[model samples]
Target: MAHKAEDRTYDVIVVGGGPSGFVAAIAAAREGARTLLVERYGFLGGMPTSAALGPISPFYFDDEQVIQGIPHEFVQRMVADGGSTGHIRCTNPHGSGSYLCFYDREAYKWAALSMILEAGVTPLFHSFVSGVRVEGDRVTGVSVTNKSGTSFYSASVVVDATGDGDVATLAGAEYVVGREADGAVQPSTMMFDMAGVDTAAVKAYMDDNLDDFEWASEMVAVHPYSERLPRQHFVGQGFKRLVKEGMDAGELHLGRDSVLFLTTCHPGVLHFNSTRIQNVDGTSAESLTAGEIEGRRQVMSLSRYLIARFPGFENAQLIATGVQIGIRESRHILGEYTLTADDVMSGRKQEDVVARGYFPVDIHNVDGVEGYGEGGVWAGLDDSYDIPYRCLVPARLDGLVIAGRAISASHEAHGSFRTQGGVMAIGQASGTAAALAALGGVAPRRLDVAELQAALLRQKASLRRDPERAREERRRAVQAVSAALAEGRISAKYLADAGTFTGQAPRL
Candidate 1:
């Protein structure tokens, strides 16, 4: 029942309909490119919709909104639709000085589709990019398989926003996967939602027993628990004692030690991001299948445990789970420039900067166990770091640019920029660059950075930092670090290891 269709051509083609791909397609089309967006799923919004993830994070660094343009516009639309609470201050102790945008998954799907369509981007849904047409060092087009049968789509420029570098890999681009030392990727999660929860009871219980929560003491030091918990949107992570008791009695099989929950705009519905599936390779179907199965099992166990023991959850019901397990890390295509851990930690700026990452290095443990030898690593940043255009341009490859989590970065750096806000900004940059390159008849690497930056700025994208503010922030951070050292809040070894912030070359 398969029929061959005539090959379609476009000025730009973006594969993947996630955060990055969605924005990329819209940006390309708005820039006057005949753009096409291909998605494996029938709908868009990527992880937030398909993976049931909520509360998009790192929209702000300190007091500044570092990520803007198309991503911000999408949020505003979602807000106007009553699908989101807009951007709210993050109260989580681990992610201080950040903001999160909470929205309904169903709303995200419709909003994304409407925006892409309004921008004149052609969207091909339920189509998988099975292969790419490469001539010499450039990718000419992609071969996709859908219900209509196999078809070839030619484009002047291609954007790989697959979140796994699928197009780049198919086109023979060099890439790396997982941590460099051990080759182990971050653990995956299966996010789920529950309804019929008594939020009042839960909040009261947390307020009374703040000592039972992880980082509760630190959070309370700044913002009181009562003031921090919003009725419509709340995020809490803690339940160590309960989880331990469940594990001891063989009632829980999940690896996580704490329960992470986020409240939705709905009265009593809450999202749970507590399920952890370990050692799952996202690129392999077999591995993903196993991970998904395990994740569902964990979700069931977690929901049952919460209902039986947790306050206000006695009558809670598991409403829905993610369609698939959420992969935190995957293949990073090697580009002209690889964003390094130093670049992210030092808040390095570059002349060719296209995007800024404000999220901290949040590496979820590769192994499933929590609070063991290496449960996880969360290193906060005092300011934002720049991501150069070269990170999107694959080395030795033409006609293609990478976006989302798969953009070229060291393992540690990827942890920061992989968040939704960071990737959306990156998508805007990559899409604009792709359109400019295709229109100008040049490779993405050969496109003028000035032209790209100007186009992005005109589109309301946030790229440059305020020089005086940046200097003041740096000075404040230095002072804080020194004060911490003197007060014994940090060790001398930690300061030595943090390296100098004086703009000098790092010592061997």
Candidate 2:
């Protein structure tokens, strides 16, 4: 059978409809661009929807709401829909300085699709970006494929949110994979869910055994045994002795001493973040296949052990697994700015900081201690660190912007900003920049920085500020916007539900 291939063009094309790509597509379309979003999966929410990577993280910094704007809107929608646990305090044995939103996977997929359609983004699901179209070093479009064969999509600006930097690498962008010395990337895990868990009993057990587990890092400060303890709901109980018993009895395969668990918005259902598959390269098809096999194998043994020993899981049943294995790190495209671990550790600020990553350097199981928490100890972010615009720009490319875990950051810094919340902000910033560049008919490299920042502000993106100074600035801005919102200074974009509004204002 012969298939006819067609070529289509858009002002902006966002590849990889994950946490980053979906937002990028939304922002571009909102900018009035003929935006097209291409995703490999049938549904959006790469990790959250596919992997059941619940609970969006770091919405609050120092326990205050930090990340805001479109992603926040998505979170609010999740909460209102009864699909999420809203915002829960950190209570993981790994430590409790961050917050998470345990959202229902299927609900997230629906909400994401709704947002994408509402933004006027033409979403092509069940298709993937297979190649990039370039003129010299500038990416002009992409080659995509599906069961129907192959096609081409031309765009004025291209946003690479493939997480693995597939489009950027296909466009001949220089990239670093895994760690610098030995080429060992962080292990990718799979998330699953267990239903019919006696969560109250489990919580009671953890409450009684708070002193048994190791925290993610010393940076995470939690006053143990106080009211602040339940915030560790996301943490896996550290039953070192019991885990060893399982291992000694040949019931456990992984070296990790604890099984991760998180509570969901739905009662009696718990999110399971176990099954760590290390040393498998996500970029390799063969490795990923083996990893999935091993992950599934582990899930069975782990689940059996839980039902046999752990409380609340005796009647538990395996309900879900991620659409794919949860990939933590893959390729870091050499961008205009490579954010370093020191930058994340020291809480560095930059003049052109467009987004903030409030999490720590959480390297999962690369150094072999265990995959439970951060691989190393680093000072916690005093407030939050800024992700500069240069991180999105490839060092030698034009019209191609990278987002999500693929941004130009050192191996260490990648660990911090790789989470969903951090990636969401990065995506919004990259999307906004792509739209501005396309609208102005200029290379993203040449778009006016101030003008772009102003555009982001109009979208209600929270630009990085001195944490101390932003308090007053945020106070006044919130007051002004609240008053304006009440006095009919409202647009459909800003008129959603009752929530603390962030960002300066939207441009009508």
Candidate 3:
């Protein structure tokens, strides 16, 4: 095949069309950049669309909802299309607070694609960014492969949103893989949906069985799991509690015609992310392959369990599986600043901050103990800390900006930053900053801090300052709750949800 040279240059070329890349392309184009988005898959919305993920996880910033910029618009569109419930659940992550929203994956994908088209971004699907072309200290373009073989696309700025930092590492950016010393990384889960579930029957079943913790414990103990991450028996019951509260408050109606039914949706659809693959290095292709294989097997088991044990699900079937490997760990590109776990716990603000991660440090480990059985614990700083612009700037790499889960941060901090909601936040800021840097004819690191902050604000990003004050406020709240827990002033369950746990002992 003969490769032909094209005489076109884009103002911005974004690699990896996941949550981060999709938002990056929209942000850049909205800022008046001629953007081209390249995705490895056939369509957009990396994990959510391709992998069939449900909802936007870890989406709130304290009581104030933080995911309100470009991503919010995409979500709203999905809700309006009758594709999602748009239910925002506020969870206390080990006493730390977080928000999650349930969304229809296909609806969200279409919404993202619509945004890109509306913003005039040229999306090249089924294209993989294989290599980066560098000239002097600046990245001139990227090498990509498609059905047409290898080709080059030149751009003034490149945003790497491939959750694994594929483009960044290929561009010679230094990065860290997995955890140091402890050899722990968040466990990966393959989410699957079940259908033919009767919502009312499912709710009734949970109400009757959630208190049967002993029975669940015995069953899970015998379950063939390679890792022993504490499985919470009360998660189903907890949701039942929430439902009761909603019904009492008149916020949720559970009747047959009610669209807000708990388990039943469209007559037969249920989603599960129960396949847990631990110690799987997300960056290594071999490990990822193994995880995928195991994920499929786990989903098959879950399908059997649902059919045998649960009501409504007896007729339910596993209709779909995630499109890509649900990777929970990957490379962390070293930047000018390494965000520490302490920063996240204290909600430390920074003068040079470009974005804030309000989600807790949800550290998921293979040997991690179980207490509540939901997700991981949030031991990070109170409130949220700023993600310094430097974290996105790959160390010693010019004109290359790393976005999404690959940004420089401690392993603990990565949990807070790796959520889909958090990725969209960082992606918007990084994309706009990259476009501005390209226009200014300077490397992303060399761009003026004030200018970058101004650009971020213009794009409606909630980048904060004054870390010390935020830290003090959060510290006071945490201390007050810790004292209450110590004196048995509050229920342990409540403390766990509010993120107020203060012991080496597990909460369960």
> Who wins the lDDT comparison?
1
Q: Write the per-residue lDDT of candidate 1 for residues 1-508, one digit (tens) a residue.
A: 3433543889999999999999999999989999999999999988888899967875767646688899999988887887777665443435323456667788799999999999999899899999999999999999999988788999999999999999999999999998999878888999999999997788667666666665321110111122223433446667788889999999998868888787776778878888888889999999999999999999999999899999999889999887778998889999999999999988999999999988888887776567423568788875699999999999999999998999999899998888899999999999999999999999998999999999999898989776676566445544544444455443343122245422333222
Q: Which whole-number lDDT from 0 to 100 does residue 283 have in model 2?
A: 84
The sequence of per-residue lDDT tens digits that candidate 3 reaches over residues 301-409 is: 6566557655666777788787866777778888888888878878888888877787766665455323233445545456767788888888887878888988998
Candidate 2 Cα misplacement greater than 4 A, ranges: 1-7, 91-96, 216-234, 369-379, 466-508
lDDT of each: 0.82, 0.75, 0.67
Off by over 4 Å in 3: 1-4, 91-98, 212-267, 368-376, 465-508
Worst 10 residues of 3 by lDDT: 214-223
The 10 consecutive residues of candidate 1 with the worst lDDT sum are: 216-225
TM-score per candidate: 0.88, 0.86, 0.79
Give me candidate 2's TM-score against the actual structure: 0.86
- Kindly indicate the candidate among 2 and 3 with the higher lDDT: 2
- Cα lDDT tens digits for candidate 2, 343-381: 888788888887888886676677663534356333466
Which residue pairs collide in model 1, if any?
Answer: none
Candidate 1 regions exceeding 4 Å error are 1-7, 92-97, 216-232, 371-374, 466-508
